[model samples]
Target: MTKPSIVFLHGSGTNADIFRLQTRKLAALLQPHFTLLYPDAPYPSGPGPGVLPFFEGCDPFATWMDDSSAAAEDAYWSLEDDDSGAARLLESVERLVREEGGGGELVGVVGFSMGAKVGMEVVRRLEGREDAGGGGVKVVVCVCGTVPYRGGGDVAREEGGRRMLGRGVVRVQSVHLMGETDPWRAEGEKLVGYFGEEGRKVMWFKGGHHMPAEDAVNKQVARIMLAACGKV
Candidate 1:
C-alpha cells in the first residue's frame, strides 16, 4: 500500500540534510505510516539561529526566500517576489512525487521556522488551484512558524501591529508546534489566527525556536501528526 506523504521543510539557512538530522527521531516514528519528502530551499542563505557549532559542516544552507536583516515579522514586507518559496517548493515536491514512482501520496506539509511560512503558502496556493493533483493537501504541520507573506503588494495588510491575511483564510487541517520560550512564539500564535477554528491544533514544546528533543514529546508530536494525517 502507498503510505500518505508529508513534505518536510527545514528552517531558513538550513538544508534538507540538516532538517533530516533534526527530525530523525520523529521521522523514525512516522516512517511506517508516511513517505516523508525533504527538499532544500531554492535560494542560498546564511546560517539560521543556532545552526553554527554542531551543523557547521552542513554547509551551503538555503532559504525559501532571501535572508532578512529586519525583524522576523517585518521581513516579509521586503520580499523580492510574492510567491517567494512556495512556487519552487511545489515544483520540487511534484518532481519528487514523480521520482517516487507513484509512491508519493502528498497529503500534508510540515515546516519549521521560515519553512512554516512557506508551508502555509503552499496550502493557500493548493486551495486556489482546482487542478492541483495528488489527492490535494489535507493538513499542514507548522513548527515554530509564522504568518504567510508575499512581497510586491499581494494583500499583506497590517492591523494591530501584526500582518493579517490578505488573500484568504486557510481552512485546511493544521497543527502548530510552538516553543514556549521562543522569541517568535507570538508570531507563531499570530499564524494560528490565520487558520479557521475547525481542524486546527496547537501544541507547546519546552524549548526555544527548535523542534522537540525529549523522547516523550517526540512521541506525542508523532501521534498528533499521524492523527492529523488520518493514520491514527
Candidate 2:
C-alpha cells in the first residue's frame, strides 16, 4: 500500500527545514499516517518593504515571490517572468516524487504564510494538467496564508487561478486557520471568498500573524487536514 504523501510548505524567509512552530508539532502526528515532503523556496529572502525578511537569525531564508512593488509595501507582489514562483516550486515537488519514490498518492499540502502562497500556486498551476500525473493536490490547509498577488487584484479569475476555480485539475477544498489579531486576517478571508461558498472553512485562533504552535492546536490542525483529505 502506497502511503499518501502530504507536502509541507514553509512561509517567507523560512525554508523546508524550519517547518514553522505549528508544522513541527503537526509533523509528529502526520508521520504515522502519511509521507511528509518539505521543500525549500528557490531564492533566499531579500529586502521586503520594511519587514526585515529573515526568519529569526536563520541564514539564507527563502521566499517564493519577490514582492518588489511600491504598492502598500507588504501588499503588492510580482513574480519575475524569468524566475516564475510556481514553476520553481513545482520543480521541487516533482523532484521529490521522482527521486524520493514518494507521492504515489498526494493527499494535500499545508502551508504557512508565504509557503501557503507557494502551495496555492502549485494548485493553480496544475489546474489543467493532472492527466500528466502527480498533479492531484486537491486538499489545502492554509495557516496564516497570504493570498497570491501579482501587481494587483487577487488574480484567481485569470490563468492558473481560473483553472483551479473551474476544477480543471482537482476540486480543491481548503481549511484556513487565521489569527484573530493578525493584521492579514482580512486578506485571508478574501482568499476564502475565492474558493466560493462550499468546500471551504475558516477557523479563528487567538494570536497574531502565526500558526498555532501548541500541541492542542497542532492536533486540531492535523484533524482538519486529515478530515479534508478524507483520511479520518
Candidate 3:
C-alpha cells in the first residue's frame, strides 16, 4: 500500500529546510510509516526567534502572512479576521498533496509556531468542505502553536463582549506540544482549547519554544503520532 502523507509546516521567518532540521528526531521515528512533506511559505521574512547562530547560515526565511511586529500586535488586539495568507497556504498544501502524495492518503499535519496556526486554519477550513467520504486531515500536531486568525468567521462573544471559550473547536484529533517556560505558552494553551477535548492531547516540555530534543520525549511523541496514523 502506498504510504500516507503528513505535511510539516515551518514557523514564520523560517523555511521548510529549517523546520526539517528542527523536527529531525520526530521525523526519524515517523518516516517509516508516513511520507512527510514540507513546503515553504509564500512571503519572505527576517529570521524568526531561536534562529540565531546555529541556523544563521540557513537564511532566506519566509512567513505565511505579514508578520511584522506592528501588524501582529494590532491583529492580536483587534482580533482581525484576515485569512488570505492562510488560504494561500491551503492552496500550497493541496498542490503538494496532489503532486507529492503519490496517490497516497493525506493523513496528518505537524506544524510549528506560525506554521501551526496556518496548518490548523487550513485543516479547519477543510473540515467545513470535506465530503462524506472523509478526505480531511485525521490528526494535527502543533508545536508552540497559536490560535487561528478567525478563519471560521468572527468568534462569538459573551454578553460583556468577551470572546467565548471553546466557540470554534476544531473537530480533529490533535497533539499539542507546549514549552513549560515558553513566552507563548498561553497562546499554545488557547490553541489546544480550540480543538475538541476528547481527541486532543497536550504535552509540555521543559525547554522553551522549540522542538523536543530529548530522546524519551521524541519517542513518546512519535508513539502518539503513530497512533494517530493508525500504525500502532
Which tens-of-lDDT digit does each residue in 36-142 have in candidate 1? 88888877888989999889888899987752433333544332355534555666777886676257667878899988877777777677674454347888888
lDDT of 3 at 199: 84
Sliding window of 10 residues with minimal summed lDDT for model 2: 72-81
CA shift of 15, model 3, Å: 0.8
lDDT string, candidate 2, 1-232, tens digits: 6777888887776666666444677788777777888777777775322234334555566776665343522332223232554566676787785666353666688888777766776776565356665366657888877765532344532443443345422248888889888887776775665554567778888887776756777787788777766777
Relative to the true structure, candidate 2 has a C-alpha RMSD (angstroms) of: 5.0
TM-score-wise, the better of 1 and 3 is 3
Candidate lDDT scores, in order, read 0.76, 0.66, 0.78
Instruction: Report the Cα lDDT for residue 219, model 1.
Output: 90
Steric clash pairs (candidate 1): none
RMSD of each: 4.2, 5.0, 4.4
**Candidate 3 lDDT trough over 10 residues, lowest sum:** 152-161
Quote the lDDT for 27 in model 1.
92
Ranking by TM-score: 3, 1, 2
Q: List residue ranges in candidate 2 displaced over 4 A.
A: 20-22, 46-56, 70-84, 101-103, 131-134, 150-170
Residue 106, candidate 3: alpha-carbon lDDT: 79
Q: Which one wins by lDDT: 1 or 2? A: 1
- Candidate 3, superposed: residue stretches over 4 Å from native: 69-83, 149-167
What's the C-alpha lDDT at position 203 in model 3? 88
* Candidate structures ordered by lDDT, highest first: 3, 1, 2
